[model samples]
Target: MIQKLLDSGLHWEKKEFGRYGFLKTSGSTDTDIYFVEKGSVRIFMMDENEERIIRFGYSGNIIVSLDSFLSGKPSELYIQAIKKTIVRTATKKDFYEFIRSSEENLKFWNSILEDLVLQQMEREKDLLISSPKERFDRVLKRSPKLFQEVPNKYIANYLRMSPETLSRLKKS
Candidate 1:
């Protein structure tokens, strides 16, 4: 679905970011959708003082701060580059206009939205599991490639566990 959008010849601004570079910052109304071309990006927010991991975008993935995009308001979310990354971006208006231009594009957008909702539900289920092992296993089953693309420290944060615990689980 995302590939279809990328292949649609829509005007996209190709941008590059160094490690820790921010794509979106907290307290900003940034509704741009990004398509990752290389490397990776992390979507997070500060919880008190701690940075809470929310989601990640790898090569070939489309990412946006959805809440901001949908609500047209500033969000607490922050999007950052995990490494040297290249992404193509389109404004919310352009994206919607493109989708509206054709029934097929609309279906593609719907599928993408559906997948996002389902992924959120799966994350909720993972959070409901009290056991760390269960959460680890569930995520591994769902997105095994995450382990390869993201650093263990960030993965541990996303799983709400310590780095040592994640290491232990990996070793087992």
Candidate 2:
């Protein structure tokens, strides 16, 4: 279904970024959505003295600053390549036109939103109820690629644990 949409006149620009390249920067109003073809992206925000990682997007995933993209506001988040990466991107205008073009497109858009919401809910629940070790274990079980592909500091921030804690967990 996604491939169908991508095939249906939605212009996709393929580009490569070096590791740590900024795909979207904080306070930018760019609303381009990216489909990861290879490698990973980390969505994050700088909070005072710390970098808080909101999420990691890998191959076959869509990466977007949803609030900013939808509202046409400056995004508070930054989207950065975690490694050498390939992505296909479509601008906000093109994305909306495609979404409004057909019932199928609208349905697909809704499904994407639903999945995002569900994932956020699960993440929030885990943060509230699970131990740090449990969260780390869950992430490892679900996306072991993150451990190998993303740096330890980023992973520690994403898991809401200290780097020392993560190192200890890795040893155990």
Candidate 3:
């Protein structure tokens, strides 16, 4: 999968993660980077000194920080691979060049963004209208393989529930 992504013209190298590793912020250099492949990256956003599990990405997924990468601005979010992983990246310069040179690349990114927006909207709707059980079920429905790949604690955090509560819910 990664080889196919690399063959498509993105530039990146593989990276590994410790038990608890972090991708530090680049206060100055904002690059248009993406994860061409990732085994299990735990993505998060920090607010009020609290860490919130946002999303866990699998292989063949782009991992660019939208605002930061596009605008060359700093990002508040932090992303780390919970498990060892491989990632591919493209810089902002490379991205723009690719867009101008290849309409196919532009379409690819546009489609990815569209899918992301739709998924986010669905998550928002679930937050508003779904019960905890329903939300959990929905998560499973959307990403059935995630339960096998990600730890339950992280899943609980992503679901906005305590671990104990998640355990009880899972049992029931």
Candidate 4:
């Protein structure tokens, strides 16, 4: 999508986020999506004081508040920088226009949506798995790069386990 936009003669500014900086805060209606040029970010919501991570975007990934983008409403999720990051942004309008501008781009967007659906289904299945070890193993088998790119503590939260449990699982 980033490349497609660039190929379309669209120019964008690259923004920097220091570690722990917020790109979008909860309750803001920001319809912008960012391509992670470097580093990583996480999309999460607070659940009674607990931060539940919904997703992570690593280098070369696109990050956005989907609800806000789709509904044009205040977002309940936070897009936070996990490390110092650089991102190029596109608004929802530009994104839609770019994707609809070409048949190939439309197919590309469709493919991305399909992958997101599949990933969400897998995440639901993972949450339903009762055993921490099983959840850990399933995720590891599916996205081993997650373990490499994301911190164990955040991964543990995503897996609904303690960081200690994740460490033990890695050791085993």
Candidate 5:
């Protein structure tokens, strides 16, 4: 399914996320974030005052901001690669046109939307009820392997705790 979509004239380009990639604040469209067939990426969240590292995304994972991109508004987050990475991207204009022109594309997008919604709901629920440490543990359990790939400070921020607190929790 996805293979066909990729084969379509999806204008995707690959670039390395360097040490100086800025968190773009004025994105007005959704984009397909794909790691090259060989690399990985780190997603980050940044505001005017501070920056927070969020998640490590590997090859085959899709990065789409449905709400902000679809609405032609600024996205709430920024993305960067933690290592040498390559990504294929398609903008919001391309997304809608593809759906309107092809059934397969539409179906693929629908499935992606469902996955995003379910993940969003789950994250929201976790935020509502879980303590900081509990949330941290949950993330670790879900992706036990990622801890080795991402830095400790990034993980600490994602769990809404300081690096010191994460260190203390790690000991206990």
Candidate 6:
């Protein structure tokens, strides 16, 4: 059903970006949700003088700044390519129209939201209760390919650990 909707009306365009390319920057009003076709993207925000990674979206995942996309406000986060990437993107207007077009679409949207919420809760729990090693282990268990696909520094940042700690954990 979702595929049908995407195929029928969503104007998906294939976009390619080089590593470290910025898809959307802080204070940008244009909001487009991207489906990763290949490679990865990192969603992050500036914290004082540092880049605080919020999440990493790999292949077969969707990436978007939810607040900016939904509220029609400028984004506070930066979405950047972590590797040479290909993604299919749909504008915010097209996405919302599709969601409101039918009951099935609405249901699908709700389910996606539920899944996002649950994932967020689980990540929060892991971050709050797990050690850096434990967090790194959990991520590795979930996506071993991430290590090969993304830079060690980005992975360390995502796991809220220093690069040195990540190196030690990998060695162990």
Top candidate on lDDT is: 1
TM-score-better candidate, 1 vs 2: 1
lDDT of 6 at 26: 93
Scored by CA lDDT, what does every candidate get?
0.92, 0.89, 0.71, 0.87, 0.65, 0.84
The lDDT of model 3 is 0.71
- lDDT for 7 in candidate 4 is 60
Off by over 4 Å in 5: 1-4, 26-48, 52-56, 168-172
TM-score of each: 0.97, 0.91, 0.85, 0.93, 0.75, 0.89
Q: Of the pair 4 and 5, which is ahead by TM-score?
A: 4
Please say which candidate is ahead in TM-score: 4 or 6: 4
Clashes of each: 0, 0, 1, 0, 0, 0
lDDT of 4 by residue, 104-155 (tens): 8889878877887888899999999999999999999998878878899899
**lDDT per residue, candidate 2, 1-172, as tens digits?**
7678678899999999999999989999868988998999999999997888988998888878988988999988999998999999999899999999999899999999998898788678668855888998888987788788788988998999899999999999
- Point out where model 6 deviates above 4 Å: 1-5
- The candidate scoring highest on TM-score is 1
lDDT string, candidate 3, 9-105, tens digits: 6555556555456543525445757673657777677667767877777676676666677677787767777776766666778667766666776
Cα lDDT for residue 89, model 1? Answer: 97
Of 1 and 3, the candidate ahead on lDDT is: 1
- Cα lDDT of model 1 by residue, 102-168, tens digit: 9999988888889899999988887888899999999999899999999999999999999999999
Rank list by TM-score = 1, 4, 2, 6, 3, 5
Report the C-alpha displacement of residue 96, candidate 4, in angstroms: 1.7
Ranked candidates, highest lDDT first: 1, 2, 4, 6, 3, 5
What TM-score would you give candidate 3 relative to the actual structure? 0.85
Error of 1 at 112 (Å): 0.8
| Residue 133's lDDT in candidate 3 | 85
